[model samples]
Target: MNTPNQEAPAQNGKRRTRLIALGVAVLVGVGLYGSYWYLHARHFEETDDAYVASDLVQITSEVAGAVTAVFVDDTQHVERGQLLVQLDDADAQVSTAAAEAELARTVRQVRAVFSQADGLKAQINERQIALRSARADLQRRQKVAADGAVSAEELQHAKDQVAQLEAALNISQESLRTTQAQIADTRIETHPQVLAAAAKVREAGLALRRTRIVAPVSGTVARRGVQIGARIAPGAALMAVVPLDRVWVDANFKEVQLAGIRIGQPVELHSDLYGKDVNYHGKIAGLGAGSGAAFALLPAQNASGNWIKIVQRVPVRIALDPKELSDHPLRVGLSMTATVDLHDGSGPLVATQLRSEPQRVTINEQRDAEVQQQIARIIADNAGHAAL
Candidate 1:
């Protein structure tokens, strides 16, 4: 064995070798990381302050009625226009019947007014003929009176008859004018009174249809608030439907990170619901108009002296691919990690164009169409052959 001094030097040499190796390893790691960051990492920004979000379409009653049936519950999937609740429609039925009857009666009344016009026209013709005859008779009597062949009393009587016939003719003409004014410049369907009644009928019919509450979107139901026997008024919330397929991420990034972010930039998201195994690809849809704190219920008043500088975050909306969203559905409020690619920095800070897809209420149009058909049927049934 060597001396203690020799042993110490050997151990020191090994330790020095190990130290050199460790230093070289650390240097290599740093160089590799710097290269990777320069080549890849620096081109992206990441934030864990993100969440899966979607529109919570609330189902509300459009008319007041008592709930008679609840057809759906929480967590159930529903299709658009699917009936989800039913209200007792007895009152609606009564009101609709009354409206229909009123429309029919009004139609009949208008038809009578039109008939009176025809009768007035005939009366005017008759009065005109009688007036001509009397004037002719008076002229003949005046000629005879000049020759003293007819008495003055007889001539005066003939003049009085002519005057009375003329007055009758004027009255008939006035009656026809008054009658035509009521129905002028409009058809039976477009008549003022008829249109007014038809509006009431449509209102009542719409209320009746409103008694059957339907889902406005296809999604899973949540927050079911309706129950049997519950009296719900107009605009009362019944439930909410969440469309998972349309879910997107709301990534809140620090103001400093927003310098490179732009609309239409590609985003890679990892949901906490599936952890790091599953990935979602999307594009930046839009940037929020204001920071979250700016729009808070009670926004921070920086006018005070106790203000500490806190980094603000602005929400960036990311729209995911439909196929990816379908394959891996996301729920609202779920945490997510979003990484935005800044490689292609050629987009606007805000969306330049309006959304291509917009929410449309086709069901309302259908309801209105149905109401029109009903009005047409009512008018056809009541409008008579006496159209003038």
Candidate 2:
């Protein structure tokens, strides 16, 4: 219905309108993506410097012996107090027997001291009677000499008998003193000699217990170096214990990033091993003392270098739920990406105070009864002979 010129101009106008719409749509998309990058991008707290660490426990032998039996091999699972290795206990047995014998002999010696005290009392009584008789005989001899009924030499002999009796009495008193000294020695449980012997017994017992190398903690054994017949000594690193249950995550955040991060703040972590399928929730335990580079073996000599400024990261230890850790075990040194929701600003950014005592590892209540019973038995066995 319209002329060709009008129709051509209208069509051209429509084409121009469509092209403008397309350009606006493209711009809108670019703006949206830019906003997303600003909000959700990985803003790293700069560190080369991550380590896979745990409370590494190095197992060693306290008693010197040839390894008689290696019960658990490398990578074997071990429970707390379970036997891990056994040393040749023949030497320990001999030493322990010797200690027991010495302890028994000490007990008998102590008993003998009491017996000696009884003997001294009896000897003192007998000497008192003999001294009385000797005095009476001397008085009779002096009267006879005065009357000239007995010779002077005979009187002198009687006087000498009295003097000899007195000397014997003094010797008996000295004997009583020596016995009393022996009793005093027996009463001292903490005497140097007794203590030395008791210490040997304790040492021998400890050595005997150590022959059966029980696991100190429940964990998986790794890097075991000892085998049957290997002679081991004190402090020789034989293996390591890997505790998957007590694993904790260390999040390194930048100084600027620390503004929102605080103790007790809620956090969400995702590990590369488990991915986003399992989300680990945690709370900020505390921030590290210094930056990672500060603790380096050879710290940067920033004084003389070409001054290039770099941001530093400090490690923030995050504590995870034990239930979650138990459900899914995480190995030490696994890579993880963490995010802290800084919504709650209730706690301090840096802890101003510290605890006076160490936080106790929860006591194992299951073994309480058994331990009490064992202690009672030991007290009963050592009661009559030794007090403790």
Candidate 3:
């Protein structure tokens, strides 16, 4: 009883002192946090609503054929122009051979046309000489007939021979003109018939190359929709190739957050696959023109009775460093956390200028050089001369 009476006041005083100290600590923490927000944290706009994205290049067949072999499967890494599937090349080969043969035959036929022109010129010259001789002979016979030394029948025969020779020469000249019309101002290779046939050959070669479906871009193969012995049609989807190296992050930031964002601003990103320990460096490549709901399949009608204001999100494209991407690969649709630095001076809100240079992807398998070389070989072998 004696201890309780004396210690109660002292215990209350100690508890008050502890409470003061805790209050002071709380005040200092709040001040420090406020200072951080003012000086540092406010400069950055962060969002976890982001994803790794890249172009999903769809690979399709340009020629109809049955699948003979499947070289690549889903999840397999493929290089650009790597053979992914093979069609029943039997049909393609036959078509190619036929086209080549037709090209060769056309070249030969064109060569004959050129030769015929020269032959016609020679024939015209021969006919002209014969006509001149016939006219001279007729003149001599007419002079003899005036002197009564030539018979009337013989003179008439001379006149008829001259007339027939003139008509023959006229026919040969007309034939020469017709022949020249085709070969005029053009070489055998440049002739219309040969050009048309070369086009056919190129078409066939391209189709034959298409039978061996290859990756258009280097990356992992996905959505493999073909199998061995499956007959596929032209323009039908066969597979998809995604270039992981060229991936970028699409950060969906709230509409209010977009005010501070600008293109060309530096960005810091973290992938869910690599965790927060791994960091990625990037730059704000672009901003979305519209919000997610704006481009949605079923956009909300704010004018309706059920209207409720919802914060819309706009996608900001962040282009990452290729080297970092290589070290820590990110696949399409992977989750990411992106933090954009708003410290820099504001530029355009979004990318205003369209891309000056067009993105280009060339097929290594269907090379024009190879096709041209083959066409030249065919033309030379048949035309009896080197292709011009």
Which prediction has the highest TM-score against the true structure? 1
Tens-place lDDT per residue, model 2, 22-133, is: 9999999998988875665433222223333467767888778898788888778888788788889998899878876675566556555656677778988898898899
* TM-score of each model, paired residue for residue: 0.87, 0.72, 0.85
Angstrom error at residue 145, model 3: 8.5
Top candidate, metric lDDT: 1
The Cα local distance difference test for each model comes to: 0.90, 0.73, 0.88
Question: Relative to the unseen true structure, what is the C-alpha lDDT of residue 357 in candidate 2, on a scale of 0 to 100?
Answer: 69
In candidate 3, list every pair of residues with a backbone clash. none
Model 1 gets an lDDT of 0.90
lDDT of 1 by residue, 146-232 (tens): 788999889889988988988888888988899889999877788899999999999999888888888878999999888899998
What lDDT would candidate 3 get against the real structure? Answer: 0.88
lDDT of 3 by residue, 232-282 (tens): 888989889888989999999999898888899999999889899999999
lDDT of 3 at 96: 85
Candidate 3: misplaced stretches above 4 Å? 1-23, 129-164, 364-369, 385-388
